[model samples]
Structure formats: C-alpha cells, structure tokens
Target: MASYELNAFDRRFQSISLVGAIEQVSPYTLNVGYWLRDPNQLILYPDLVASHPRLDFLWEKTCFEIFIGVQGEDYYREINLSPSQAWQAYQFEEYRYPETMPPQVAYDIELNQLKRTHYGLNVSLDLTEFMLAHKLKWSDLFIGLTAVLETSQAQQFYAMQHSGQNADFHNKRDWLHIF
Candidate 1:
C-alpha cells in the first residue's frame, strides 16, 4: 500500500488534512482510502446512500478521484468516488477528449464505508481483462489520486502534486504512483 498526503490547491482550508491511499488487493481488486482530519467539521458532505450508483459530475461536490494511465500512452481511465455513495468512471482518448460515453468496461465499487472522518472505497476492475483489452500490464500503469472538498464557503481541490498554475487534476504529469 502507498499513502500520500494530498495538498490543497486553495489555502483556505488549512485546518483540515486529507490523505489518500491506494493498494492493489488482488489481480482484479483495487482499494482506495481517504481520511479527512477536520476537527471542526469544515467540509460539507452529501448524505450517504445504502446503494451506490454510477453518476456523472461527482466532482461538483466532495468527491475522491483516481486517474489510471499507461506509462507511455496518452489514453487513461478516471474514477470518481463520492462520499454520497455516487461514483463515475471514464476512459479518455487523450486529455479531455472523447468523453462522450462511459468506459467499455465498467469499474464497480465493491465495498464502501463512509464515516464521520474517514471514507474507504474498494473498487474492482479486472486487471487481467483490462490488460488484455488495452494491451498493457500492471507495470505499465501509473496513478493519480485527488479529491474535491466542498466547504461551507467554497470548494477546494486536492492532489498529490499540482504541476500547472491551476489545479488541474486531469494533468497526467502529476500522476506519480505506479500500479
């Protein structure tokens, strides 16, 4: 398991701390965890649901995101997991182009836990099948973990590293973890 401290692009939420962790449980399962150390409950979260649904535009609120990309390719996959038990996944040809439809293979959230301060989500995507379809291996994939925290006043972007002048989570250059 690899853990990273996500830095906030906006400096206002200094009282809160966000940390994201990723681990490959098996050949087909991927687990991601997020902890928000908000003593004052500064972040606003949507109500949790018993059943998680695949929804779009999860980034508008408090959402956790993961970007998976092949080491030398422009194509990548993005997963968005929300505290509200809403999630979304997308496959991009390059940058933000061709987001007209969902991924050919749907990424499913197997287990999800939403607590007062910690949110744990386990997602399963067939690695063997993905490699066969994409013509890549585990070593060829890199990851980017990020989040959007919505506070009472505004929304803040968080990531392992922000390479550009703006908080662009889509930027592959900021993705540093190897799958």
Candidate 2:
C-alpha cells in the first residue's frame, strides 16, 4: 500500500510505494514488503517555506499529514495499519514537481521567484514497491487530486468519509446490504 499528505492551500504532495503482502483475511491488511524507488530522488522546494520567518523555521520539522491505501477500481481506500505495523514494513520516499530549476539565485528576480515555487507533493514512493507488492512485473502509480464529484451532497459526503475513517471502501453505504 501507499500513502501521502498535502496541505490544503499548498500545492505540494508526496506518495510512497511499498512491496508487501495483503493479509485480507485474518488481519485484513496490507503490508509493505519493500520500497522500489530511491529516497534521494525525493526533493522539497523552498517555497513550501511559510512566508513568516518563524514559520519558515518549522518547514524541516513539519510532518506532512498522510492518508494511505491502495487504489481500487473506482476509488482509493485507506490501509488500516497500526503504527507498529508501519514500522515493520519496508518503505522509501519519492518526490515530484518543478520541471526545471536554475543553477544560481542571481540576476533575475522573476527566476528567483520561480525557484521558490513548488507545485506538487514534497515526497512520493518509488514505483517499484507497487509492482513487487502486487506480484506484477510492471505497474504504474499516479498521485493527484480529485477535481469533480457527482453531486454537491455527494462531494461533501465523501469528503467527510475520507477525512474521518480508514476503510476499504470509499462509501460505506455502498457496501451495506439493504433488506
């Protein structure tokens, strides 16, 4: 399973992939067997530094709030793992954004401004984890935001669901068998 976190106003986001087994019976859980991507590739942009001087200092120590799980046919579900369980799994981080950067901070203010601009997650997981964990020779993993919902009520409803619970299904009602 993989997990990631991003600030609401902050465009930055990150995800990590893990190779592991799914104990969907007894534990009904997913495990991180190994990490596919190298951690070095993950990089953080300076813009994530909150404008305030005091807040800027906290950037390094700031923990990215994360949600984790595997993506199902129509949605992503949270992986219900205890803290101890996460510690035992193999994990790695990957980063994305800023298609390019300049070598030096000199001359152009515009360039310098762009230098601080960050548009994606601060970290991500190596893709190799997904392939290994799923028992597939190859796979592709994508991370992004959901821009649309079927209904305003549905949108608010799922937002609450996503924020409050960690489960295998996005909509608990969908899983219920009504008599």
Candidate 3:
C-alpha cells in the first residue's frame, strides 16, 4: 500500500512510497488509488459536493473511490469528486507574465498600415518577421515618424489655444520672448 501526507491549510502535498508492488490495471483486475470504508456506500469530499455542478452524474457513473483495508479491518475511506474537483484542494494562484513595452518604432501608423495592407496584414507581422521573410535589417522609420507627428501636433494645438497671456510672465519683453 502507498502512503501520502496532505496539508490542507498550507496546501502542501507529499507522496510516500507504497509497500506492495503497484498493481497494473487489466481487463479482470481493478487498480484503485484510494481506499473506501464501505462497499455499498460512497464517500465524497465536502468541497466537491458544494462546488461541482456534475458531481451527481460522475458519482453515479464511475467507480471513483477505492475500497482498501486489511481483510478483517473495519475502517475504510473513499474519495469522490468530479474530475474538476480532483485537484481543487491544491489550487494555486495563476502566474502571469510581466508586462513589456512594445518597440518605440512600432507606433508608426503609416508603416503599420502599409505592412498590414501590403505585406503581413496584421499587427503580428513585426520587424522580426519582416526581416526573416525579406532579409532586411532593423528599421525604426515608423517610430521616428510617429514621434515627430505627435510633437508637431502638440505644438500646433498649444499655439492655437494658448495666446501666452498667462500672469506668470506679465513683462512685455518676457512675454514676447516667451511667445
């Protein structure tokens, strides 16, 4: 028989070696991983009973829990749950990849549009792919164009809206120079 230790609170699990040879499943023999107390009744995990939507169907359809004990042993235990609940007790927070900034040169809409329409047809067609496909070196033309456009647009908007009449620079010479 195999032995295992499971810590519920900290969510630690350890598997201990079994004493007997691990029985192989065959047409005539059953290989059960857990032992059950009763032959007629099924034992279920409480969390599984509450959380799983198809628990009843699985319990009814499958011989999930194993019956194991000494020949004369009265004590028995059973493990019952839907396939989803089988690993619920050891659930851990999912790991998320860290955020990365896209290349500065990738922001050019013109190049992006050209690449999308004429070459790759999507954002997935990056410079790397383009280089691989066409044997071209790296290019930042799009990013530079985008930065220039943004700066010019900001300057034009600021000039149009603000007449440079703020109180911080009331002196005519200072105001004229600032404007």
Which candidate number would show the highest TM-score if scored against the true structure? Answer: 1
TM-score of each: 0.85, 0.21, 0.17
TM-score of 2: 0.21
Best by lDDT: 1
Scored by lDDT, model 1 comes in at: 0.75
- Error (Å) of candidate 1 at residue 67 is 0.4
**lDDT of each residue in 46-141, candidate 1, tens digit only:** 787666677787888888888888887887888888888777777787897775644433453233333333544444443555566777767888
Residue-wise lDDT of candidate 3 within 87-127, one digit each (tens)?
Answer: 10011111111212211111111111111111101111122
Going through the candidates in the order shown, the clash numbers are 0, 12, 4
Which segments of model 3 are wrong by more than 4 Å?
Answer: 1-58, 87-179
Tell me the tens digit of each residue's lDDT in model 2 across 114-152. Answer: 011122222222334444555432122222221111121
Predicted candidate 1: what Cα RMSD to the true structure?
3.0
- lDDT at 179, model 3: 4
The better-scoring model by TM-score among 2 and 3 is: 2
Model 2 accuracy (lDDT, Cα):
0.22
